[model samples]
Target chain A: MKNLLKHHETYVLLVIIIFSAIITVINPRFLTLENFFDVVKSYSFIGILAVGVTFVLISGGIDISFTAVATVAQYVMAVMIIRYGGNIFTAFLLAAAVGISLGLINATLIYFFNIPTIITTIATLNIYYGILIVISGGKWIYALPGWFRAFADIRLFTLCTDEGIKYGLSIITSIWILVVIIAWVILRYTKLGRGIYAMGGSMNAARRAGFNIFRTQMFVYSFTGLMAGLAGLVQALLVQTVAPNSIVGKELDVIAAVVLGGASLAGGVGTLFGTILGVTLIAIMSNGMTLMRVSSFWYNVFIGLIIILSVAFSAYQRRTKAKRAIAVEVE
Target chain B: MRSRHSELIILGCITTAIFALMWVFNPNQFLRIGNLQNMAFQLPELGLLSLAMMVTMLTGGINLSIIATANLSGIVTALILTAMINPDAPPPGSGGIIILAICAGLLTAMLIGLLNGILVAVIDVSPILATLGMMILVNGLTIVITKGYVISGLPNAVRFIGNGVVLGIPMGTIIFALCAGIMALILNLTVLGFNIYMVGSNPTASNFAGVNNTAVLIKTYIISGLYAGIAAMIMISRFNSAKAGYGESYLLVTILASVLGGTSAAGGFGKVSGLVMSLIILQIASSGFNLLGVSAFLTIAFWGFIIILVMVVNFISAKVLERKAA
Candidate 1:
């Protein structure tokens, strides 16, 4: 129990539980099974994107172009299916390829040029988004194929509500959970994951220790792109349409959630469990705001405040931990 | 030769070439005084925002909250004016209330800057995350107060600052030039400015040299906020309204301008003259594209492309210089 308490994820988990309890008390409807599933479903997209970003952040790099990559890849998938009459499998395959291709572009720039990841991604985001808009002529793809819509409806279970019915679990949620588990396992058990963490710890040291920086960066960014691509498809399917401009600005939410969940921007830190809890906390915050009849404008205000506070708290914790280590050394 | 002046020379050459091309292709539209005046009027808003970005970048920090600060300040000033004047009546002609409103807005921006500075300098939060949070917070507050509606109908005194011309030049352009001059003076002549460069180049060395790093950073951000306030005033007057969501696309462009102007994101480098030339180059390029009947969206892509090109050139030049030295 003490060991568990020592972990950063525990505190985040505690916050989520406390927030959920308070919101449930304020609005009894918040505790309903439907609401739980609703939060899970909504955060699934962010959750999937966060999985990839978690790795990047842990690897001591940043990727803001994920949302753009996702948008373009999703658009490509949808356009191929709608225009070229491709199958669902072919569409997804092409989407992943596009995602990987874009991610590799970001990776290559950062790796070869030694430019900052944030700056490179910022430029590429504009390039990718601009090309997408020009090619599509800024048109909204509202009507999607019947099969595409049906893909999201692959339900694991259903619940009968007093009003009518509710979905208990769907493939979307399953994918979200599965991705988290995969990220967890990779970070904990894989050599590449350790190399990423090592690179974040100290680039020079990692290089001296025979860790391949280029390969690690490529894996990190490409993996993020692949997941963003998948998340893009899921998001489009959920919305039942594709508007190229709509999905481009939501990278902040993912970054904020990841940061709130204890992912350090300085790298060499972060965990899948903490990321999940962070996503849950953000999802509930928004959900609770809606339940309390608060204006949506306040949502951004709260999110900003929370991000500042949580990071401050974590910094404080690290300071105290460092002090304790120094005292031990003195003894 | 990979001299220090080479980038500037390259930038100059590009600007001249583009101007020559435009003069040849669309001489009538591109070289007309009326069109030049329009370009001058439009340049300052982005130019001021870019200056705000450049100041913060000097401290090796970024203030993503610039547009949000501008919007919030404008909204605050608009609210004050709206409360004073009758909703249905015509705007008052007196400039007194307008001055006060501008003061109030500038004060709000200063406070926001102080908060941002403290968050980054004192609390030791990453500048990007700190300013990013501030950006969202300020934007949300503005939306909540204005309820997503545009605050139209400002007094005429305010509009004059945006629309008024002085000796064949725009008042807005003049204001932008004055701000640039002041920034250049501060950077070149002031002790605080010297410390800013020292601190940015090496904070540890600056600290060892007894430089007040925290104070310099705080002051730098405050100046950035002040620039944003003036830009907001210009923006509000030009549009005859203020809103929470205006100029949402200026964030990245400001960064692009600063970088293209030779402002190193790594700190300890940049110049006002370079920035002016870069902004002009961009304005002409964008307008040139528009004249050719290209889509406006392509301009953004062009900005991104140019930044990459500049980075590549800078990288290659640095390498060549190193090899020559070796």
Candidate 2:
């Protein structure tokens, strides 16, 4: 019981429960099982992206270019499928390849130039988006093959609400869950994952420990790229249109969710469970606001506030803990 | 100091090279006075923004909220100006109201900067995340206020500041020069400037040496905010309107310009002259491209490529210098 109380995930879960209770009190419809699935389905893309970023963050690097990579990959996938008539497997393969290549480019730049990850990613983000826009002429791709559209309707289970509306666990949500499970297993049981944690904890120490820095970095960034690419496909499937610019600005939302999930920006600490809870909290907040009929603009305002406050709270806690440790040493 | 001088010379060479290339491409149109004046008018807003981003970079921090603060400030001034001055029946003492509105805008930016400073320096949050949050918050507030619509119809005097010419120099250029001069003085001559470099280079050492790192950081961000406010004034005046999303693309460009100026991404090394030179180089290239009818999107890609290329060059040069010294 004491151990559970000390966990960041516990607090996140508590907040989720209390916040959901408040929202349900304000709007009774928010408590419906249908709304639960709706929120999960709507935010599955973000959850996937957050999971990918969690790996990068825990590896002591940041990648703001993932959204750009996702867009470029999905754009290529859409173009390929639309023009050549490929199956879903082909589409996924194309996206992952594009994503991995772009992610490798980011890794190569960081490794060779020794530039900071944030700076390198920012530059690449623009480069990728600019090239995409220039080549595509900012055109939105529509009329995806019927097979691709049908893939979105593939749900494992289905239920009917009182109003005869069908709500079920979606393939997208299942993909998110599968990604989380894979990430959890990797972080907990894999040597590569241990190397990532070591690198984030201290690069010099990790290097001294015989951890291959380049390989870990390559894996971390490319994993993010892969997830981003998949998320991009998921987005198109859900929306049924491929807009070139739809996914760029949501980088902050994903980063915020990951951070709120107890991932230190400085690196070396985070959990998949914590990240999922963070995503759920943010999704719930936005969904609750929509139900409450608040202005959509206020959604970003609240997110910004939550990011500052939560990070500040953690920093304060760390500072006091350090002070207390010093006091004990003096005694 | 020697390295700084060399960096400036390199930047100067690059600027001249681009200018010559543009001239060669379009000798007839590139050298026209009208074209030069147009470039001058367009340079200051971006120039001011680059400076805003530069100062924060010098402190080992970044103000991602700089553009958002600028837009919100411009919106605040726009709201005041539109409310106070009736375009149909202009008031006699409207200039005072315009000044007041401008002040209000600057104050709004300062307040946002203060919040960002508190979050970063006082609360110990990372600079990138803190300013990013502030950026989103400010942007949201601006959206809420303007409801995603453009505000326009400013009085003539306010427009004069952005468009007026004096002694053959554009008003915006003159304002940019004055601001740059002030910025140069602040970074080079002031105690605060010394402390800023010290804190950025080594925060623990500076703290041990009795520097108030928190106060210095707060002051640094406040100055950054002031520059953003000044840029906002010029932006709104030149466009003759204010909106929630003006200059969204400028954010990346500012970072690019700062990096191209030889500002160390890790902080503690930069120069105003270097930054000014890089800004001119960018303006020349962008204007030349416009004359060449190149797509604007390609130019953006080129800017990204240039940032990465410059970093690589800097790294190689530093390595060569180290080897030579050995």
Candidate 3:
């Protein structure tokens, strides 16, 4: 029972992969480069945010305002690059600054006022969306300079593979990969990462253990915000335009991917690799549905069902394990 | 007397300041009586939603899908009205079907809330996940049932309920106030409300103290669902239309009202009276901006900024509590 509880994420991953493989064999298009690339391109930015936000989730905090934060970052970048005549480097930095500041705002509220993360995030979420509207004045900014869009040109920049990034390896995809690797290293090797997990397991206990939880929380919120900023930048650059309302309902998809990827809403358990797999699983589903020409109407239904089933089963398996352990102890 | 006076002062200070600003700025030009009526008309769903938010939150959980349920309820009402009214067949504006359509919506919303409660309380899914799951499912169900279309042709009686006013007060505002009063009454005067607070404050401890945690949690869900239904009815009546997408944003606003009003998102503490004030505060803030006559786009940020300011106030108040506790 203990083993299963510990390794349920692994099992979920295995099952999903096998399912994907089976689907691939049945429909060769799923294996084709075009479909796979499409999946990568579509899911990369969301995948990046999921990987970052997983840190906050595992630390027993939720950041529901990330979509708003991302939108703000996108707007800042658009305004900087086009209206202000700023270089791409300056634009990206400005965007990142906006995100980090947002994260800091959230952290300060939860830590100082002892306000709940949910409430704080909800407020900030609106604030960011507000920024989006106020900045654009309810209009789309379409004429992004050429230099800004150049960021999307390198699919993989002639990486070790022949498939160019636009066909597969876009800058956003590469940067997301880099983030995953960096996060993995931090989680596996750094004391700060351990502090994150410890805080999630039990903040009181973590504090008793002498971990600086306030500091850790601040760092987590900030890190996630920075990543959200990066995501917004990529999204802005890719489309060569910014729409204030583009990501209105996308937060759910990102959260679903995080959960499906084997992270717990309860905190203290999840991996970058697991989240990546989770993002892929969702991306695959989205891709497959598109390939099948399913109505957008059904996409939400299927996705929603998948999210509920995955989480529900995980919860059920947990109770079953507790029952078995009690029986074992009795024996 | 001092505390009561202070709360009254705070409420008056906040609301009156907003009113002074709007009035000083000469709001009646673009903020016409019609727009004011429209705003009042919109408040029922938001008000009912805020009440539901207060109850669930009093139990220390959030139902992120209230809007979805409300949306679904709206769909059901539309469907029910259509089936009864027959837009093509007769002198199609018969009004008797109005009450029936709204009843169906409320019942459906209540059922959905019951399901939400069962999942969260019994199945042990966190309320966030459970309600979120319901949100996604309900949203899609709304689309599917409506076939991704707006279901209009509301019974004139129902449409009258949405459009009609009594003594210069829109039906939506009247309904909103009525629901708010009911929720406040139940929470303050009822045994069920007491149990909900006890259970939410500490589940294991509450159970040890003989409070039934599962029952309490389940009841909150029921209340939450009923509020959604009420909100759904108001929305259909006011718009004279029920789109699958119409009620999507109310969930956020109502929840904001609850949390901003001094209900701890952590549960175990809430005041519907405070929520009422908070709703008024939000309405005033939006109304003030509308009065200012700037781009309505700033409206969202304006709301967000107000919520953030409310939290700032909440945080300071918590510090005061901590000092007193010490």
- Measured by TM-score, the strongest candidate is 2
Q: Who wins the DockQ comparison?
A: 2
How far does residue A77 in candidate 2 sit from its true spot (Å)? 0.5
Which whole-number lDDT from 0 to 100 does residue B11 have in model 1? Answer: 90
Model 2 alpha-carbon drift over 4 Å, by segment: A326-331
Q: Write the per-residue lDDT of candidate 3 for residues B57-143, one digit (tens) a residue.
A: 888788888888888888888887787776555344455566666778888988998988888888888888778878888888888
DockQ, candidate no. 3: 0.60
Error of 2 at B55 (Å): 0.9
TM-score ranking, best first: 2, 1, 3
Query: Could you give candidate 3's per-residue lDDT for residues A106-138 as a string of tens digits?
Result: 898889877677778877787778766775676
Error of 1 at B258 (Å): 1.3
What is the C-alpha lDDT profile of model 1 across A12-36, one tens digit per residue? 8888888888888889999988888
- Per-candidate TM-scores read 0.96, 0.97, 0.91
Worst 10 residues of 1 chain A by lDDT: A322-331
Any idea what lDDT model 3 has? 0.78
Query: What overall lDDT, based on C-alpha atoms, would model 2 receive against the true structure?
Result: 0.89
